[model samples]
Target: MRVLIVGGSGYLGQFLLKYLLERPEDEVIAVGYTYADENAGPIDHPLTKIDRCRAFRVDAATGEGMDACVRAMAPLDLVVNCAAMSSPGKCEKEAELAMNLNVPTHLCRTLLEHNQKSEAIAPLLVHLSTDQVYDGESPNSVEDVNAPSPVNTYGRSKLNAELHIAENYVAGRHVSLRSSIITGSQPPLRPVSRPLFHDFIVNSLKGDEAVTFFEDEYRCPIAAVDIVAHIVALSKLAGKDAKTDWLMRYNMGGPDRLSRVDMARQTAEVLGVSDANVEAVSSASVDRGVISPADISMLSNKLNSLTLVSPMGWKDQMRLALGMAKM
Candidate 1:
């Protein structure tokens, strides 16, 4: 199978790329972008250095170089979209940028044009969405049962992106995964400076400065490897099944519903680190510049039924992420 991973430079995207490349039967193309910097050239991610993977640099926000990317890799079997400006505070401050990057309008248009020209089945689009689409009032929210009520700009942008894919790609070749907070370490091949929730807790415990965790905010944090596995399983399924009439949307998350404080305490216990600097605070006490949902825990019954892969527990997820457990 031939696959295209947009935002392949991201944390989750890198994991997908690494795992997919291991199959040896699939050809993987990674498309990543970098901000313009006079002082430095584009980022030289270690994954791009691998000879087996074909890498491209494109600005998904502006659609620059996207047409060339699609044209170069014609008749793509699958396209996993992980591109997004995911920071909630940044999304709230720069609403337009968030809308442009998160919406996937340009990416979908390019793919549609490609599909119109090609005779092969349209490449299945596995888009990574967020669980923030829920209003936090409900827990273990089901995809079809609960109505999406995004309160912040980040959630709104992602919800709009899902709508666009559903409207345009009605042929059921597209899937929207409303994923919760993805918790794991950076990909081995591609190290990241930005820390994830697990990394933040570990760093705070190892350092002298205090780190405050929200006791009110709740999320079912799925491991990065689990997310990658789901995408890979879907890609394999798409290869076998040619049916393109059923629209797919799944709530992708772990089984545990944990608050930030809960996660921090767990991390401390798992890694045998001190939680002395880990401060527990309510979301109401913090002014993060965006309205945070109190509880967006999701039930992944649909995803499990489809992929046949159960979500990992938070403790095992932490071990896998920290390289303490086998993959």
Candidate 2:
């Protein structure tokens, strides 16, 4: 299978790219904007990158660099979009650019148009969305609901993108995955990337003994590796009579209900930091932040009904995360 990722350079995209490459029969093509000029070579890495995978910085906004990027690739079996101007502050600051680059509302429309006109295989579109949409899922809401409160401009824009993909695109050709914040390995020159858990471990390990975490904020989390693997699995199911998710939205939380404080404490445990070293502070105490929802839980996996697979403990992944971070 030939796979393409929109934001192949991002934290989640990096994981998606890595997961696909592990399969000997798969070919992964990673497309994104390269901020650093130095590492923008042919993108052939040893472990994480297979020879079949190619990563390039293609600016989907303004349509610059997209033609060549798309033209060079083979007809794709799957196209996973992980690209976004993901930062709320960044999206709010440049709303228009955010719409173009971050939201990709227009860009996705263009891709569908291109798909209709071109000879390339109409690939399954797996758009990675966010749980921030629910603004912590207001009272009486169930896990299957796709409607969101969208607390920030970023969340609103992401919701907009999700709607566009669902309403305007070809049916049976797309899926929207709404997951909580991701935590994982941060690649070099990729400061925009930070794992929610690993960052705390790093902070704790660095002798910043007293680490501050948001007290009121809540979120569901899945490992970046798991996210990519799920996406890859979805990619393999393209055009098959696979079971559709509820209303095109999925809740992708880890097994545990975690707050910013819970994540911090867990990181402290992984790093062997004492409980006293982790502090639960209010969002207002932060230098820069948002008055976010008290909780935004997501449970995307339909494991019990479909495969009967139990959700794995998040702590094990947390341990791997800290170990990898230290290496």
Among these predictions, the greatest lDDT belongs to 1
For every model shown, what is its TM-score relative to the native structure? Answer: 0.91, 0.81
For candidate 1, the per-residue lDDT at 213 reads 90
Maximum-TM-score candidate:
1
Candidate 2 on 145-260: residue-level lDDT in tens?
54587887778877888888878876767777777667655543244444455665556656745767777776666667667656656565554445445346556656767777
lDDT of 2 at 31: 35
Residue 24 error, candidate 1, Å: 2.9
lDDT of 1 by residue, 107-139 (tens): 899888988887668888999999988899998
Per-candidate clashes come to: 0, 7
The local distance difference test score of each candidate is 0.81, 0.63
Candidate 2's TM-score reads 0.81
